[model samples]
Target: MKIRQLQFFFLAIFFVLILSGCGSSSATKEDKVIKIGATAGPYSDQVTEGIKPLLEDKGYDVEVVEYTDYVQPNLSLDQGDIDANVFQNSLYMKDFAETRGLDIIEAIKVPTAPIAIYSEKHDSIDDVEDGQSIATSNDPVNQARALAMLEDLGWIKLKEGVDPTKASEKDIAEYIKKVEIKPLEPAQLPRAMSDVDYSFVNGNFAISSGLKLNGAVYLEKTPPHYMIGVTVRESDEDAQFVKDIIEAYQSESFKKLNEEDEKYEGYVLPEWMN
Candidate 1:
């Protein structure tokens, strides 16, 4: 009876030690894991090429999560599925979080690819003809951006004293080219190049579809607000990983990668990098 009791005592101690060790290991692994979210194209490449290696060097196990749509990355971050995201501009982030009741914030701006006018039917802006058609984003914010570009190109004229950020098709005071402006889904805008005389393609979608930046007929002068950044939950805004991400983005290595790579050509760089 004494021997059996001692054996049971030893077995209990062993199990406790094993369980405690496993718990510590699990905690350490969890601490080292960092999941970043980005869209399927250049943004994801930014994570895979620019951010991931830097975090890995700091002993983190980085995972780049690719999202197909604009909303899911923010939703996943709010739900704790991803640690950070690098897809949307600060203005878009603010609007999204405000409307959806998600507590999120932008960490820092990354190199952003500007939206540009693309065409399969025309080679240059000079080729634009009156009464032709142009497809652009249907979303109010992006549509406003496209309209602003058209105005700059002397293809249209917006109303006096109109807020450029909020300007829409209705704000166009004059059609300098008399072209029909068709607003379509952003993803479909690339394909619309086939059907319309021209389409304004968002940078990410254009790059994903193998359209080069140099192929654009006219690129927008991307404003700082339109620049995309790394986003995180509000609570995690000051976390070490978030700080590291900012540091990585502002690092010389990242700047070199962006400057030297043909893949990143024409991307509007952040102020720090400039």
Candidate 2:
């Protein structure tokens, strides 16, 4: 009987030791590293130069994983390879998650960027000539905004009442001014500026590729839907760590970084900052 009691006591102590190990492992949530995803441009620059320092100040380790492809960031987020991603706007991400069946949600809005019309061939809009070739993004996710900006500038006209979000070159019911429309990949649009008369280069691409945002021939008004948004898994939306990250992102430090960077000049103000 005494032997049996001794054995049970040892077993109980072993289980207690195992539990203690786990408790220790789970202790101090701040020790966990937060992995953020972004593409190689101003977005990643924000995470590295701004968000990382802020979070690190709050005792959080941050790792900014940079990707060259837009698709990989979402894929990495959905597969739990990343804790969060912040490269896309609400509209683009919404369409991405729906089409790809990824259970991701945009939990916070980041700085927006105007879909700018740039031209190396032409000094200004006044210099534009009829039938000149123009380049814009071919990505379905961003094609509409590019087209919308062109329409807004009185270059083309979409069908009346047609949703700009879904608008494409096919929706061009009228050409306010005659110009050739070329749908090139977003990155290519910037470099192709020398080849095409004008191109709608994404803000980040324009900034990173050495194009001047302030010098754009035309900067369109950014729609609310076009602002960049931070995305996380819907399941992790309420997690305390996620909340901490969001708070850190919305901090004045982050806002200042966005504002100081020409790439983010107009779109870096956090919603709460207003």
Error of 2 at 160 (Å): 2.1
TM-score (C-alpha) between model 1 and the true structure: 0.88
Cα error, candidate 2, residue 81 (Å): 1.5
Against the true structure, what is each candidate's TM-score?
0.88, 0.88
* Residue pairs clashing, model 2: none
Off by over 4 Å in 1: 1-28
In order, how many clashes per candidate? 0, 0
Candidate 2, 1-274: lDDT as tens digits: 9999999999999999999988878865634778999877778887888888878887887899987667899999989888999888888898988999988888888776667788877789777667998888888868988778778778888999989998988899998789998998777877898798888888777777876668888886776688888899999889877888888787877777766766566553545667
lDDT score at residue 96, model 1, on the 0-100 scale: 84
